[model samples]
Target: MINRHLRVVLAEDSVVLRDGMVELLATRGCEVVATAGTAPALLAAVVEHRPNVAVVDIRMPPTHTDEGIRAAVEIRARTPEVGILVFSQHVETVWASRLLAGGAAGIGYLLKERVARTSEFMDALHRVAGGGTALDPEVVTQLMRGGRRGRVDTLTPREREVLELMAQGHSNRSIAALLVVSERAVEKHVAAVFTKFDLRASDADNRRVKAVLTYLAESGG
Candidate 1:
């Protein structure tokens, strides 16, 4: 379904990985419109090229810290149509949460190891480009564990399950399918879960999913 010949911008400090990613995307019919070795360069390229998607490293030059993620946020603010996929060597769950604080849609956070799997990497890019979230399973697991413990215990077992699935970037329809419940039932469960977590009125801009993802990422689950 990802037939669009996407124009992509890549931002990675490492030359080897950046080249590899460009080649990979080329082979998959994507156009590598631009590439940058630092956060500032990445932002400049994205702004100039106005690429359809940007594959950014969570850690980029200057500080070798969270520059890439910061650039992604700036991209989201300036160009809403430009999808962002952040790659990281470590979990950096807080960075992920911040990148998705507005909403996971049109955004992705994946561990660097995932790049070795061509199909999976492309799928993540495609999903992001199509306005869907793509979260690494490992990252989700870690976040869910934190939520499992502590005060989040007020959530029922089923609500916990729902929250976990939501953190995994599953849609209400998809969650319903996985839980073997009707969409209406899933909606009720999600509402209850949100209420239990004091997330009422937190659905501004349909950002409840973003709120959940943010909680999980910040919890380091």
Candidate 2:
């Protein structure tokens, strides 16, 4: 469940879309502390409010190219504690890779049209705000296609499936349910993936995030 007091800073160039999002979040018990229509304003709002999460659009004013993503990278560097969710109309793998280079915790990249339900969108927001990943399945698929076939090639078909699901930000139990397998089976597959990726147990780093990072890096994204 999402925290009713979840605070958010929204960034989008479209007034209609931005206002719609603000209303949507408000109805779901989230507070939109600030909203911005440009990358500079978005950065300022985040720095000032330090909201739990910031929902950003990929394209904004001026170049209408990568300003949003660039600002997102800056936000990650400046305030690692604030979560960022990229709500874009298109999937730019290179941009996604750059945004996630530092880490996957408290990061999300979701395609706007692909998000079919309100619950799904809210769940993603909650996950990112709580220091979790929320990658879209399509993003995962494209990254896998471009990924270098090194350690990833050695995995069994089932393990690859598990890894793909993991990249999509699914939990072990969720993967098990989707694959129609037992949670124990999913755990085994997850363990194998970590070992294959040379991700050792660590108190300072999340192995799951590490695995996903490896997958993204291998993708050259």
Candidate 3:
């Protein structure tokens, strides 16, 4: 179980799924402060309740296209402190790219059918709420396959591999383990990626998150 109590604002158009989520979260020691079936209500709840995280669906009432994503973007802009998790049945890479355009810290995007285990979902929630990334592997795969080429094209094959792992929300140490290389090697590749992507060091922004955003922005379809 999560040690910290996570206050959540759940926004899903389907009542059954929403209730199920509420119960699921309750079972795991999370509190659903407010629930919303529309974008406006979700925004309002986020403002009023100031939840630790907002679990949002990609589609919602009155259009069921991109309402939830737009609201998530607004929430990031207005209150960057509150994490945003996009839980959806569809990939919707275009919308996902838009949501990450601002930043990747405290952001998560997971596909409903792909989340095979309760542990996976809960882990993602915890990661996002704690100002970390938790992107679905499939999301990263789609972005990589169709991602455009520009500055990203300048990266070496190994550097590109490192960036893809980063987009999958893997840390340098994890990437090193997965690649069977030394962590120092992984750090060097990461630094090369940062340099090639033109992500300068900054105290205000997370370079790691910015690098992932650059990868998504360039790869956005």
Candidate 4:
């Protein structure tokens, strides 16, 4: 059994799935504080109830792409105390990485099919709610094969683009030219990327080289 009865807010676009999850959680000794079918509704429900944890589907209404994942990210910013378990039928590595960029504490990313059994799903949920990791084995293996455990995963999309350009031996000015941005703007992104990677050096040029090497290593080259 889990540590205690947890208050949960659930978001799943499919009415059938949402209702089924509500019932399943209730039976597992959880309090289903709120249920939502869309990303906005999920945010609102979370704000109102302040549940201990939220189970959010990666896809949701209107677009059905990554609305749920985006909302979950925002929820984390607003309420870091609320644990998040992001699930999807498909493996979206970028989204998964983004969800875990900050840290894995109180976070989960499990494939929907992996939860075919109620017991396993409940266990994963409880684990996340109590500040433990519950990543899918496939997800872990796939991410690992990229030669990136989580450090590279921590880079934002734009930052990754900038880093890639840097790794190609592009100077700040050259990177700006390639990306069609000002050199000053590129400098900010470069600094942010290096800070995220925690690279240190005696000089700026050396630091950039180290960052580029880290990127190459992460790319498995």
List clash counts for every candidate, in order. Answer: 2, 1, 1, 0
Compose the digit string of candidate 2's lDDT tens values, residues 1-221. Answer: 75657999999999999999999999999999999999999999999999999999989999999899889989988998999999998776666766765557689888988999999899989999988778886776664444334787778999988887776657888899999999999999999998887777862446675577666555442
Query: Which residue runs of candidate 1 sit more than 4 Å off their true CA positions?
Result: 143-145, 149-192, 198-211, 214-221
Q: What lDDT score belongs to each candidate, Candidate 1 first?
A: 0.76, 0.83, 0.83, 0.77
TM-score of each: 0.70, 0.70, 0.70, 0.66
Residue pairs with backbone overlap in model 4: none
Comparing 3 and 4 on TM-score, the stronger one: 3
Model 4 Cα shift for residue 28 (angstroms): 1.0
Candidate 2: global Cα-lDDT? 0.83
Tens-digit lDDT track for model 4 on 1-221? 54599999999988888898888788878999999999999999999999989998988888988899999989887997899988788766556655655455677778987776877778888888987667776665554344334577788898999887765446789889998999999999988987887755543335564465456456642
Q: What is the C-alpha lDDT profile of model 1 across 150-202, one tens digit per residue?
A: 43567788877877677655788999999999999888888887676555574
lDDT of 1: 0.76
Q: What residue runs in model 3 are displaced by over 4 Å at the alpha carbon?
A: 147-221
